[model samples]
Target: MSWSGLLQCTAVEKNGRTVISDCYYEGALKLTRPVYLHPSQPTIYLIHVGGGYVDGDRYKTEIMLQEGAHLIATTQSATKIYKTVKVPVQQYTSAYLDDQSVLEFFPDPVIAYEKAQFYQEMTVYMKESSTFIYGDIITPGWSESGELFRYDWIRSKLKIYYEDNLKLFDHLYLETSTGMTGIFQMEGYTHFGSLFVISPFMTQDLLQKFESMAARFPASVHLGWSIPMIPGLVIRVLAHETHAIETIFQMIHQFIREECFQEEPIFLRKY
Candidate 1:
């Protein structure tokens, strides 16, 4: 029902603290005042005025962090993509990080209802001295009829660049045409989640530590950790529910906060 929306935000360090230097948004996209809850980072929550996205909607965002700045960007709530008959929803995000800067982009999960079609493309450009943490989840929307994985399609791609050179490219493509019920596809799972950390802090030692954590997941859940061509680690998870994956990501976030930033994890209270 909407044409498109755009949000642009720039962050800079001032007096040893990160602040939103400039921000602008249009259409359904909105942003709240940046909050410095933690001494090491400033937090910003993106808000959707419309509550959910619908067919024919296109949204894009760009975030820029100046040198030595630290920011955590997240959404107020889960993004819901409603059913569609014709047009598909499209979303694109681009982030630029200067040397010694840090960015933590952890939006809530996305729920795709029956017949919904969604596509997302994200690119992050950073210096080798910068740190980045990004994550997302995709789950079938609730249905009164108890149907799941009925969405028409859900495709997402993420690309990371260090020193303006491509370091990692991750992709996920799913469609109803491929039979979502197939064991090789969803494998009876209703949700999939991913967490990525790109930083010089992610050494082989830390990778081994995270691998120990991933190995503790229950048999019902499929969790894997891998080192891509980039200088970081990726955590991929599939499960019948969402809470397990969410908890693991939170633990990973906490680990990064304590080890790399030497700061305690501040609970992101939305209420």
Candidate 2:
């Protein structure tokens, strides 16, 4: 079944200096239920909904954040792109952040079955003082079913903008036989994820703290935090074990929550 929905959030300061709006979609199969979360009175809301895909199934989501507002959005579970003999399954997501606004888009993960093809893209617009933390986890195939890295193709792109100026652009392409043993490849890792955190308010000391915490993990787990082009930190990890990667992500998320939001992480309780 094909389904679609949109989510919008707007914020305005009391002095009426700034205004912004954020919108997105949450839709999937009709058989499953959509997850919802209302964190604050009128500022934060999280919704996650997805379902099985058969033939010619399409999923799309869009999010927009108005100026001066803060928003965090996450998925309840990883999205599964089922393999089909006839047509390839598609999932599209787009996000917009208004001037002086912040948005965090971190989905659970995307699981691709053998012979499945998937495409994804994420775009962000930023203004001065606007911050965004975005990431995604991708797995080759279901481990429980004895399936290893057997997907056909998985492609992703990320674009970042500061006002009318472009800050960062990235593209990634992966396949089952992408060579997991090479020095620059996945290096025998079955699952991988990338995290990008952008904020001008971050200090050198804080960056050091984050890096130190990341060093506690295994050497195989790649971690890097920097402010090379953008005023934020980026972490990339590849692990042969899914749980290990998940644990590291959870820890990093919690650290950011405490430092940025001054609130406890919510996903731990929900998971």
Candidate 3:
């Protein structure tokens, strides 16, 4: 059936600290109480009480960060897409960042069950001085029948705008039943991941540093970096185990935190 959920979070500076002034949710979506891990940054967790997305299920979230505000948004767990007959599971997120704001959207991976169809779209509108980091990981769902890549299809799009000008638009689509060459084929990898870093801080030297960092990963894990056709840095990975990609993500996040903010990365405790 048709189901939709909405969540909105607005942050503003108060008393020398950035705080979530208004937080609200409706329908199957929910949010934990905002946590202040640092003075300028507040952390929020996205929760889906329905457990997983099914056919015709829709969920949306919007985040507004005022000038100089900082926020970290993550999910309590991985988003699961169950089997579907015809309809698809859709989700959307829109974020608006004022001047000099910072946002980190780092959620767990999505596992698509057999015959499942999933779609996700994310849009970010921000000033030229804002900093945003977004990531997505997908893994083949486990099947008792011992079959992999049985899902019908999965599609995702991420678009970012700088002061009304489109700066980045990334789209991806994978179909398991189409017999398409190299669609989900990465030397037998079962999972894939992509990370986007959008900020004025990205320089050629920093991109080279990231390339050097990828060299330390095992040969089994294929790591590639490319300067996106847009105005950002993109890193892609193909791995047999999901944890391998996650470990590298942690390293990159840590490096960004230290280099940009001179602070340690927030280790979110998953309950």
- Top model by TM-score, which number? 1
* Higher-ranked by TM-score: 1 or 3: 1
State TM-scores per candidate.
0.94, 0.79, 0.93
- What's each prediction's clash count? 0, 14, 0
Report lDDT (CA) for all predictions: 0.87, 0.65, 0.84
Ranking by TM-score: 1, 3, 2
Please give the distance, in angstroms, between residue 261's alpha carbon in candidate 3 and its true position after superposition.
1.4
Question: In candidate 3, what residue range of length 10 has the lowest lDDT sum?
Answer: 178-187
lDDT per residue (tens digit) for residues 90-135 in model 1: 9999999999999999898999988899999999999999999998
Collision pairs in model 1:
none
Best by lDDT: 1
CA deviation > 4 Å runs, candidate 3: 1-3, 180-184, 229-231, 269-271
Residue 209 displacement (Å), model 2: 2.0
lDDT per residue for candidate 2 within 216-257, as digits (tens), equals 877767655556486787777887766667778778877886
Q: Model 3 reaches what TM-score against the true structure?
A: 0.93
How well does candidate 1 score on lDDT at residue 43? Answer: 93
As a whole number from 0 to 100, the lDDT of residue 181 in candidate 1 is: 61
Residue 18 lDDT in candidate 2: 29
Q: How many steric clashes does model 1 contain?
A: 0
